[model samples]
Target: MAMDFSNAALPAHYGLHFTPTFHSKIPPNIDPTSTTLPNPFIVVVTGAGKGLGYHISLAYASAGCSGLAISSRTSSDLDALASEISKIAEKRGTKIEVLKVVADVQSDSDVSNLEKEVRQKWGRVDVMIANAGVISKYVEAPSSSGSNLPRGIVQDADWARVLDINLNGVWRVSKAFVPLLSESKDGPQALISSCSMAAHSTISELTPIAYNVSKVAGMRLMECVANDHGEEGVQAFALHPGAVVTPQTKNHAGGQWSDILADDEGLAGAFCVWLTKEKREWLSGRYVSCNWNVKELEAKKDEIVKGNLLKYRMVV
Candidate 1:
């Protein structure tokens, strides 16, 4: 288990020290529905059939993005999401071309096919949201279970599967779509992946060991992407979409953490739009939480960059 660090003890820039008034909901400054994106902008979101993915796609459509390509493993879910996007376009007296694709991130062929389809339709991608991820069954501590059964990462049958989908999946999407982002005629090309605080937390009771390790490795991958691709005009970010409960989370350990999952589903979606809406290169390649107030985050820009904060590093 990791150390039991307290959020209140962390710095203001970490965003865990927010007042009661400014928790996890979407703030007015970065609300997508009230914002307008540039013309001819195109975005691709994976695992977008439901949950935070659905809301993120909706935010782009609400912001008047020119085109959107959303993918998921379920065809029915894509159909439902597409219908909602159409409704939003009509209501706002705007037009948004929605392309739906069915894909499993674990499959190389499926991910390639998704990239091919998007390239054929839009010829370029402005933003890529690699949001497909999965968690393994809980691995109880040896002390908790009476039997001497295996425990933690070594014991979980689905350990490899979680890393494959959560960590390697991010790599697959990045490998396929980053080139298209570079082809964009606009500014601020970005690749944002759904990450979690579990990357830094060691609370075994809250999540499985595989989930925690995959998140840590995933953030490191984001950092590597930023270092390698910043010269190519592609900015990458690891995003901790606020603690919102969806089908994925509700079933975890029979809803054990449901009480703490109070963030609005719209928070992360709006934050994505706000992140890539303009070129804030200073914040690229860092870990950001949707629950953080953007205004306060902006205020710490100089300190963040100067101190090289938010990226993982050894304390010693």
Candidate 2:
């Protein structure tokens, strides 16, 4: 599928009364100073061992966040990332505490234990980035093969594995952490998402049904959290961090797609940093790409709600 980065069309639901002029003055990268604003905020980043998670952790560190808890399946990778961030903080003359936890996001016990540790260390958490995800072979393939499993033909084991970490895992972590975030005087919970172009476009051949379903499920989770907790000062956002050239994508790409993935990594990383900034609240519960805020997509809010209801029904 061809990717278009231009900002030309706006969905009618955005309630955009006027066509805003595109400005070249928008900073190409996130200003580190914006992250250091008052109120020491504690952040927890899942899947922080590599890829977008690694960069997101650094963004928080640059902002002088109080402390960060990094979690991934591999302890060594998490420790290495924490060590690098520690050095960066030291050079900046800021104290950013780093905690490494090895946990499989798929397991309830793991999520529970990680939450307990964080609550013990810091009574409150300001940000929770539910970023851990796995793209199984079904979703990672370049195209569907004749012998390939049916679309959405997720095996019992694959279903368990994907939903466990992608959907249920996020729920477990979010539910566990909400109490801590609620304790905070100021509340902001950001849930990071990958590109949801599949949700918007019919690319079943290029994208797997399971992966699309998982991401769409993820977006709804954020919305439900926002609706339930917004009045309490907790705001939730679902962010599409663009395409980043990561090890996972590298293993999935076949031909030209490989080059596209490689080129998008840095741009995507920069965009994720910018999206985490304070100004992104405007794009809450909506799909975003290439720094383009798809607030118009918010019109389908009811559909998102319905999708969540159906998913819960199936799970229950």
The Cα local distance difference test for each model comes to: 0.82, 0.61
What RMSD value applies to candidate 1? 3.4
Residue range 213-249, candidate 2, lDDT tens digits: 7777887787787678665656566655654566555
What clash pairs does model 1 have? none
lDDT of 1 at 161: 89
Relative to the unseen true structure, what is the C-alpha lDDT of residue 288 in candidate 2, on a scale of 0 to 100?
Answer: 49
| Reference-based lDDT, residue 287, model 2 | 51
Clashes of 1: 0
